[model samples]
Target chain A: MSGIRVSLRGKSFPDASGNGTRQVLGELGFVAERGEFVAILGPSGCGKTTLLNLIAGLDAAYEGEIALDAAAGNAAPDIGYVFQNPRLLPWRTVFENVCLVLNAPAGATALVEKFLAEAGLTEFRDAYPEKLSLGQRRRVAIVRAFAIAPDLLLMDEPFVSLDGPTAERLRAMLLEIWNACPTTVLFVTHDLDEAIALADRVLVLSESPASIVADVPIAVPRQERMAPAVLEEFRKRLRQPEKV
Target chain B: MFHLHAIWPRLASFFLFLLLWQLGAMALESRLLPLPEAVFAVLRDGFQSGEIPHHIGITLGRVAASFVLAMAIGSAIGIAMGRSRLLDRLFDAWLVLFLNVPALVVILLAYVWFGLIEAAAILAVAVNKIPNVAVTLREGSRALDRDYLEMAHSFRLGSLRTFRHVVLPQLSPYFLASARSGLALIWKIVLVVELLGRSDGVGFQLHLYFQLFDVASILAYTLAFVAVVLVIEAVCFRPLDRRALRWRR
Candidate 1:
């Protein structure tokens, strides 16, 4: 347990959006073995996104310490963030949006092509976001975030607006890509089924100024995880009322 | 592309106006208010005599020079003010002062400063135009989305790339809008400035006609200048506006 890989321990100051300094993560302790998927589930105002921000080093105004094991490599984990909204630049075409991540690398066109193909957006390489449907735009955002091949990927409820079927489809695609790249993914979602469908462990959060109330591990394998009956059990566990 | 069916009523009203003016000429029986046919006759005669083109060329040259100067300087200052609140605040009082003060006053001031030179006329027109462009673009820049800018930062795009790929595209509509109105207004002011200060151009020509109380010649010159304004709207502003808005459905 002590040899576990990535972990963070800190209390972050609430943001300036009148998000008061409430103990969101509350000396939050978690450890992920290498290549693990963690689903963080919480209510709407819960600071689930804030926790991911801390992990991504985007928010440093915090009280406690957070560290990743850097002993094995010279560089800390490369981080990629997919915001709640698609947030694709309206002026840029889909290919240009993905290729924006290829600053240092060569052959930008080829990399853009690869990701467009992977994201099933090759037909839209030149299409603007205004032309794309909601689902297509979300896919472009995901591909852009993942195209850089980051060591850690943080997603903040990236499919809130999609239909359930489309969300499920994307979840499967995301799992497929995650398996290939094998990066550490800290996923945040309001949907319990989504959390259970993708994660090795589901961390449930309390309401605003939130704290992690439970971290439930999934014993099932990825292939059998999304089964209707298996998801029902996970849903039942998450539905229980909160304790003080 | 010019829709006359929608404006047929206005056309009818204008024809009625011409008929009324002809009737008024007949009633008053005064040479100062010449009949519409007489003004048309004067226009035709002036065109045949070739003096019309010379006067038109001079007026066109002045308008073109002033319009270009206004667009260049107006757009630059407007964009700068829009991008920086400090600059906007610093220049706000001066801009308001100019926007409120009469164009005639500015032209008079230019005449005093520069003595009827082409530069004086151009400067007068440009000064009138800059505040308008700056105000429109300032609103545009203020309303720019921070989300797009944040995305640019994450991409690590260079300044030129970011501007070309992100900022300018968003700002293109604002630029087109400002340029169109600014062009129209500066040219109108150019004519006024010419009438007051310069000895050449359409305004000066109109003043020469006015002195003789030659209503036919005055109406002829006015119709010619109005036609030029129509040509600018058709040939330049409309097509450019369409191209800039191509991204929209």
Candidate 2:
């Protein structure tokens, strides 16, 4: 199967209030040859969300052209985004919320069930957003995004609010889902441990006027992902500040 | 369902207030303020002779017709205004004008234009109710989440299907709230219209009572209307609201 790629050309980052515009990313480029999971780690308010928004088409007030690699006359690659918050419509039951994403391509019940079960939300499918605990709501959001089966999945700090155990479980679940679908994922997080746990390559960003400071590729084998020694090594490497 | 045990204190308070009213009537020896027992007797006789039912049914029918007409037109206009910036801006002045106009003045205008027919009375009440429903629903439609709508668009949901599955469900609470307030306002306006126009409904009966200085009969008709309003609250509005917001609990 042919590979899918995306490029952002000439996108200027907005300046901080009253500060002069500084180039954040200059013709910043990266290519995922085939199926690759890339994690973008950055300091708070360093344009991580801005980058994701530009990619998601949620904001078009930017100077850039983003291109998709797809056959002529074919549909553009579908993108599913998991926001920092669950952002579930509080009024809908979990089942109804997931079913909403399926309105485009018919017969998406199986996809909803698959992701719900993967995310351990099978029993809570009928629950509303307010009734579920925080972790459960986060899981619902994750599964809802995954259910869409977008060619590109963008997750923005999806587990930032969860407890350690829940975050670990979700990170494992995310990897499993990624393995199952092999969708190109752009996972953005502030936690180094989370980046190490899931991403095939970790892209670190500068403090502000953010640019890719380092792109650290994962060296550990998938089989030894959960092993304690491998994780310790990953943690140590993430702590060392890169040459600015 | 009655929760009688929970409301016993309030019921006792009501009885005490009535007792005080009865005592005051006896002390004053006035025909204008009848004793509670005398009003109860008048209510019993009115109900037994079916006068209460006849008046109540006429009042209820008028209110129902006007309320239904108002809700239909108001909701349609509200959805349009909420959905379209152009329509909202174009009709905003008209909506503001009608909302501020006094109900009695509108009824008077209807009387002059339509000559005190049942249609005029109903139209007057409907005119009073329409702006309320429209304004509430317009705000509701505006407050709907754009993300949910985008999700719907991406799915390519048909307009009717989107309305049923997404838009309607979100707007249900607003609709229910509008219904409750609109019903109360419509009933009150309908009574006034009936009193000023043709000779039927509780309002006309009360007007007749006023001519004869029959305070007891006026209170009886008022109690009957109050009972019907209570019945509507219990049987219609509360149940529908509970069902619409069932997801909350």
Candidate 3:
């Protein structure tokens, strides 16, 4: 699979206050190579989610070009997205919810079962979303994203609002899954520690009318990325006034 | 098992109602207020002779046909209006006009324009109901969760799948709400339609009994029809409602 190129020169929207248009992205550009994990770190309301929307094609009103290079022998590169919420259909069972995105081709059911087992939701396959806990539901969302075997995956603070222990467990689970089946990922978060722990490269974003302020590459090895000292160093660097 | 426990209170209330009715009949001592026993006797004889069942069957059929027509057309129009600003603007005035017009006026006009035919009867009942369903479903469509829709879009679930999985479940509650209220409104309008022009059904039977001042038979037919409606509410709608909303837990 080839890398995905997103070159957004100018993307803006009309301000909700009925004022003039607000520019969310100014000359923003990046390329995520195949199997690369990139984290977009920014403060809240910094149009981080808007950038994901543009790549996912959910919002087409933005200016500039956002293109996905098709993989070899594929019509277009398949994209998966995990929103701020689990967003499962309450009426559907956990298994059926994941199956909602799968075409009924040969071996589809097996793939669904494999993903469910990976997420430790095999017992709750028939359970509805309302029956699952918040953390469990988030796990279901992650499994659903991976079940499609997407070439490019996008996540918008998928672990937000979760308790510390639960969020840590899910982050580890996400890394385990990604290690098994590497894909181009663009994870958005406001936490420096989370970005450092998850991504190979971290792109820090400015406040609203956002622009890429700093593109920092994590040099620490994968296993030591979460060490207290390494995390402290990244935190100290992110706290610097120049980066903000 | 719990259902049996729930039934006793309802049974107690029903018996209490009968006792009060019996007292009213005894106090009035007038032919106008027949005893509950007399109404029951009429019900027994009418059922044995198959006369009451025929009227009920006809009325129920008319109600079913009109209800289906109104709901199908109303939901379609409602969704269109909710999705498109132009369609909502175009139909908003029409919906208001229909809603405000008296049900009697519509029935009368339908009969006068189309004559006393089955189609006219059904049309009048359905027309009275469509506006309400449309308004309700439009609100449901507007309140749909946009985040779920965006999820569907990101996953590239096609239009049919999106409607089935994302759209329909959110709308089911509104559909049920409209249906329950619509059924209540429609049965009454059906009776009125039958009373005015129809030759069969419980409404026509009531009209006949009215001329003779046969209060017992009138009450009997009315009580029987109410029983059927209650049975529908209990047997059909309750289970469907529970199934549709079971995810709320």
What TM-score against the true fold does each predicted structure earn?
A: 0.80, 0.84, 0.96
lDDT of 1 by residue, B1-43 (tens): 6488978997999899988987899999988888889988988
lDDT (tens digit, per residue) of candidate 1 on A27-125: 466776557788888888777877876666656777665565542553555566788888887766787777766665466667668767888888988
Alpha-carbon lDDT of model 3? 0.91
Superposed model 2: Cα runs more than 4 Å off: A1-5, A9-29, A69-76, A104-111, A207-216, A225-242, B76-92, B138-173
Q: Evaluate all candidate structures by whole-model CA lDDT and list the values in order.
A: 0.76, 0.80, 0.91
TM-score order of candidates, top first: 3, 2, 1
The i-RMS of candidate 3 is 0.7
- Using DockQ, give the best candidate's number: 3
lDDT of 2 by residue, A1-244 (tens): 1133444444554468756665554444566544678888888877787777777766676665665564345476667778787777777899888887664546788778878887888888888889998888878877777777666777889889788988888778777877887777888998887788788888887765565767789877776766888888876666665443
Please report how far candidate 2 places residue A217 from its true position, in Å: 4.0
Q: How well is candidate 1 docked (DockQ)?
A: 0.35
Q: Rank the candidates by DockQ, best first.
A: 3, 1, 2
Question: Model 1 segments beyond 4 Å from truth?
Answer: A1-36, A50-80, A91-106, A110-114, A122-128, A148-152, A180-184, A200-203, A211-220, A228-244, B2-24, B48-50, B83-85
Q: Report per-candidate DockQ.
A: 0.35, 0.28, 0.86
